[model samples]
Target: MNIYRYEENPIITPADIQPYHKGFQVIGAFNAGVAEYNGETLLLLRVAEQPISDDPNKVLAPVYNTGTGKIDLVELDRKDERYDFSDPRVVRDVTQNATFAYLTSISYVRIARSKDGHRFTIDNEPFIYPSNEQEIFGVEDPRVTQIGEDYYIYFSVVSPKGIGESMVSTRDFSNVTHHGMIFSPDNKDVLIFPEKIGGKYYALHRPTMKSIGTPEIWIAESDNLLYWGNHKHLLGLRQGMWDSGRIGGGAVPIKTDKGWLELYHGATMEHRYCMGAVLLDLEHPEKVIARSAAPVLEPEADYEKKGFFGDVVFSCGVVVDGDIVRMYYGVADTSMACAELSLQEILDSLVYE
Candidate 1:
């Protein structure tokens, strides 16, 4: 795969963003949703921020208090036998077998604008934040689809209840109307088709199943965007492959003369994430036509190889202009980057199974 990475690969980083709170630091500014709006490229960045803690033996977790509309800080002692701090991202309580974040960070969506696709300027304030109980944990990994004059935003909402998919739509970026949770708990990585197929709305989602199922991509049709059904399995993990561990949908499916081009992310058991492409039947997107045997984009550069989480290249959206596909992706789960691939090149790289 020929991936022309931007000269300034990491176009947006934590340092480029302003912390949401006074005593917190922005840890990640990646996994953004891309769209062309009002003659400018718009990036809906997922900004992750954690409370600043100077104490070596103590960890501070930031929790959003829905009642007070403020973030509450909780201190956890490292020596506490009840909790396990083995993972840098989360703390597991041994007694209850419940996992929680160590340096608890809240993720919110922020906007970055650019006249050209390369250089971007991040907004001072967040575009969307945790406002209700469902998103108390945070709103994350947004995928935006423009249908007619409105742009629909689909993202994961995390809380104590469980992680689910939520939707909201906006015409002018300033004000958005929340559409509530569309998919229930234990589901995420969702993207809606820009137009209905076969006289019904369609979506691609991943529902994490504990038994008799693996984390794979699935497609469903809906009469209305709010309720979806007629679920059909789309793609699964390929054993002994780079995507052997898990797979999920990435950018909103791009329509092409060949098929519905979908850029997706797959990971190895080692948790190294990479981007690949799949072509779905236009009339029946549930049917896969062809998939890439190898990754189109992977962690190669220092920026992609090292960060909050290492060896990762994940995308949420892309912008296609004529023959060029501008893919905006998260590098090492830390910062945002862009790469260009010829639409014909990506289609040529696909191998039918």
Candidate 2:
């Protein structure tokens, strides 16, 4: 099967996106969640902000201080440290027990509007920020779904405590009701279903266990949006496959005659991310009907192959229209890109055998 990408897509760029944090400068502005509201396409961009460094000798990042409502600059010594800072995504301590931390990439959800879903106008202010102590480190990827009149947004909130999914609701963009932390730590990539089934809410979640199990997509049932339980493993990485390293749910599940169609991201042991799809039973959300034997999208373009973090095509959202699926994805963990594929073509590629 063949997939199509928009040559003129990825409406926003670093040059077009404005910085959200006052003192810190914006760096990675990609992997945004998508939604359409009031005749406009809205993009919830993951804007990574850090201090503007002038010194060639040090790496500086901004940490939020809630009490002061300001960001504090944290400096890392590149020369003295035993750790190697060669990779943008990971930092390795060579002299020690091989300790590492993914360099600080705090995310703020900024808004950009599009009338045609190709050309967008970004807002000067951010829609969400890392305000409280729990979100001091920063917020990362976000997934948005609209059910009825209310819009439900789920995102990863990061801090010293741990990383987990949080929620907020809004009818209009003017006001948002923050429900705070909905899912516990060691969890993220939670995509709530657009509608409830059998009076129970359904969501696709990933529970991160570094040693025990790789990041896998699971289904969870909830009576209320705040509490979630009754988990069932939906999908996992295949050995020596495109998704051998880890997997997470991408755009919110799309309802089709076949089932609940989900587009998700997977990575290799080297952390090269790509996009694929899975079809699940409508009645029993945990039952997987079929899955794409191969990735629908991979890092082939120049922008996708090289950037802040290269060889990645991570997606957080999509907008479906009739038979066409307009996908918005993060390129190389640095820039936002878009592509279009046929809904039927993607479904036909799913292999049950």
Candidate 3:
């Protein structure tokens, strides 16, 4: 195997960070956006929290109240005939097309400072919380790209309206400027390139369809960082392959001499998520050059197979140094983990198509 798993494996867990409130408990601390700033490594962790209930049947959901500008805990009965609380993650309205009623847990981005890139100290307060109406449910899976001195963090904002992409930028990690929904609802896993190409900014995103089409990677161009257009369908699932189930952009596409190397997460029909590689044309990134016949990384470790959502290795970011790519990924949707891969090795793994 080309993967060099960190000896410590999961470096950050839910126990490492405390919940923002008294009654709420931290359920997950993973799916982080990684960046390097001021001689330290930063993990923009997706901290998931839910209200602790004494009664088993009483399910409490925290919602960001747009009217009062506060998070209101709404209680629901598991035994209620109009709803289905079978899924521990979400409550569904049995009355209306089995739609999502409320999320069992809410997620927000937090900064974890690591001087050595192994050990980390997590912050108590959320760096980006559910502030506006767009993030009523919460923000999840942040992907950071450094352009010049500022670090731009792109994340998912889940609300009753739908899941969308939102961005925020920080220089020192202390403060940030909010740039509202970059892509509208039903679009996520958006990764913006570090620099503009051909005097235009480029990005990779996945927008799901309701009645037609499977989840596939798409490319878009932007003049400014905010407004995006010139959308093109990039990659789709390969039948009977590891990514036959679904596919999305993982780490930010790394510029290479051969081409633009992208690390993406693909799932099987059984919902087993693994990491794969793809190579794109240098100038026109929308043109695909090669793809992975097999997964570059999969759920081999115990931590990757057992947790909040098992059989998953989802990466939001990585820190690159020459040939060494230090990948920080969320394990089973529970904790954060690190692995080192040679950039050349990932490129070599791709099969030219």
Candidate 3: misplaced stretches above 4 Å?
none
Residue-pair clash count for candidate 3: 0
Clash counts for all predictions = 0, 0, 0
Q: Candidate 3, residues 1-353: lDDT per residue as tens digits?
A: 47889998899999889888779998899989999988999999999999999999899998988788677899998789999988878899989888898999999999999899999998877898888888989999999999998889999999989899999888888889998899998999999999888899999999988889999999999998999999999999999999999999999999999988999999998989999999999899999999999998899999999998899999999999999999999999899999999898888878998
Candidate 1, superposed: residue stretches over 4 Å from native? 101-103
* Model 1 lDDT-worst window of ten: 95-104
Candidate 2: tens digits of C-alpha lDDT, residues 26-112: 678898989899999998998887666778777765667899977776677779567687875545568756644434556788888
Candidate 1 vs candidate 2: the TM-score winner is 1
List runs of model 2 lying over 4 Å from the truth.
Answer: 82-84, 89-102
lDDT of 2: 0.84
Better model by TM-score: candidate 2 vs candidate 3: 3
TM-score of 3: 0.98
Give one digit per residue, the lDDT tens place, for model 1 in 1-353: 67799999899999998897999999999999988899999999999998889998988877778999888888999899998887777777788755554336889999999999899988888898888998878889999999999999989998877789999999988899999999998899999998988999999999988668899999989998999999999999999998999999999999999999999999999999999999999998988999999999989999999999999999999999999999999998799999999999999999986
